[model samples]
Target chain A: MAWYFSGDKAVYLQIMEEIQLRIISGFYPLGTRIPSVRDLAEEARVNPNTMQKALTELERSELVVSQRTAGKFVTCDEKRVTEIRERMSSECMEEFLSRMKKLGFTEKEASEKIGQHCAKNETDPRN
Target chain B: MNEILVCSDLCKNYGQKTALSHLELTLERGKIIGLLGPNGSGKTTLIKLIAGLLVPTYGSLTVGGNRIGVETKKIVSYLPERTYIPEWMKVKDILDFFEDFYSDFSRDRAVEMLTSLNIAVGDKIKTMSKGTKEKVQLILVMSREAELYLLDEPIAGVDPAARDYILRTIITNYNENASIIISTHLITDIEPVLDDVVMIQNGTLRIHASVDEIREKNQMSVDALFREVFRC
Candidate 1:
């Protein structure tokens, strides 16, 4: 219904994606303290119970760790972080390429368009 | 205690009018549920019944394993749609009154919220605007360590920013063991904070389902479903 939720599936899974994105983007960063469930829930405007389930999911994925009463922190594992980042990038590229194909461009042409966009300072050549 | 509120064939009639029909529902603890409906849909009536402001014409409703009475009152913190604080009383005085009236009320927590909201303690209640009054009342209700919170249109008269702040306060203030039922027509604004939704129409229950289930099963936001379900 709002940011971090697409309203197509379970909120905990959506929350998990959000936290993962934060991790992949270094918003949470490696080995840094994450906000409390109450704080995160408030920030997302979601119930703390749902936020707790998401945080627990993050913990199970080894992206976050709870140190007893000290609170939750992002994982210090850099390899896992890089893996998620690459996965997200590939996912985005796949979606973009598919959309480009739907827009009447071949796979090679779509890749060439990306190359062209990267080659020029301006993204659109028509301008 | 596990089930925060339970209504079994609960009916409320006022004179010749039936405000609420036979409604059966149960709310579990640790949930933030939205009591959603259009005008005259018995949303207020249900909230009032839980707040002990009205007597049901027939059937029963229990809150925190106790029927609606003095015992339930002790564990239930209610924020009515209208201002309940005395016009003559100052903000500080209201805190004192709440602390004296409700055992669960924590004056210090109330003071903390008041300070954060930039409300002066000595400011008379009548002098404040409508939105501020709602915020103050919401803070007071959330500060109480009660088992169940019944908020009737908690953000009806507030600006968007203040509405967001009030929802955040509700999320942060309530303990893990507590559950809150917020009744409002502003579905989009309040949709995110809701874990479950209870829809009522024409003095009867329409739907009660978890937000996740609704989303996964219907592939739409609760607001979208609400529009379709209550479409004219």
Candidate 2:
């Protein structure tokens, strides 16, 4: 999975968002071993403590479990991932639809535009 | 629990003028306090006095039930507004000094932090740029497992990117049982993490309350209240 780092928000929140995205994307599949805190911090160019906070949050959410000597690993429960994906996707779609409506696009027009864009990207060799 | 720190009618005069005038404050433990004020608002002076860096002109101050002295300094780790480390020393040398003086200093943690920042231990402070030196100083201050951390303008000089790192370091390094008093005019950057706030204006304590209490009472964010209170 590709690591995304941004300075726009709190590091811990950003890390959480990125990890959730990865889980949704199937890059970090259920029961996968996530990188060590040190490695992840180095990759993200953040302090390990920031990474730890993110991991702790993930543990709190029950999406990941930490072992004593062995590092943190994703829970082998696909139900949790599915729940998170559905919740996040619905929220994002609602936001997107609201913005489109604000920009004077009707529901059908917005859906048609999105479909055309996706179709073009699928067919285009450069894409 | 009520009195993590107590200063009774404290006064500090810098020659002709008074920096602090009969200041009285009681800081409780386990709270993240924001010491808010403008420049020359006696914020730094008050912090210095409590840190035992400067002696009070009149009254007495106690930290963790003991008077401010060598013992108090041991429990309090302070980060001054400006770079306080000698410019000639290496990063590793500063670590050694901290290790020598402060029993709570975590050398391994400091070294790990330097590595994470891609800062070499052997590099001299003179060779690094000003911003990097400031980060190194912050890392050192935060690595300590002190009871009271007085961070004076920790984010003032750094760039926006570095500010996040600085805040993250504080969040990560702070011991839960300890109290952190961050003195700064930059309210927006730190308003989210502050558990309590001590608003000081013109050498007087204006307000002191938990973040939740302040929000509940004012129905506004601390940043908004700061602007309103410190408005000219």
Best by TM-score: 1
Query: Which of the numbered candidates is closest to the native, going by highest DockQ?
Result: 1
Q: Tens-digit lDDT track for model 1 on A1-127? A: 2365665677778889888998888888899999988888888888888889899988987889999999999999999888878888998999999999899999999999998878785656666
Docking class of 1: medium
How much does each candidate deviate at the interface, measured as C-alpha RMSD after superposition? Answer: 1.3, 8.1
lDDT score, candidate 1, position B185: 91
lDDT of 2 at B16: 90
- Per-prediction TM-score, please? 0.94, 0.68
Q: After superposition, how far is residue B216 of candidate 2 from its true place, in Å?
A: 10
lDDT of 2 at B80: 85
Show where candidate 1 strays beyond 4 Å: A1-5, A122-127
Give the residue spans of candidate 2 off by over 4 A: A1-18, A33-61, A66-72, B1-34, B55-60, B82-100, B106-143, B158-173, B186-198, B205-229
Indicate the TM-score of model 1: 0.94
Q: Summarize candidate 1's per-residue lDDT along B96-173 as a digit string, tens digits.
A: 888889988888888888898899899899999998999999989988999999989988978888888888888788
For model 2, the chain A TM-score is 0.80
Error of 1 at A89 (Å): 1.5
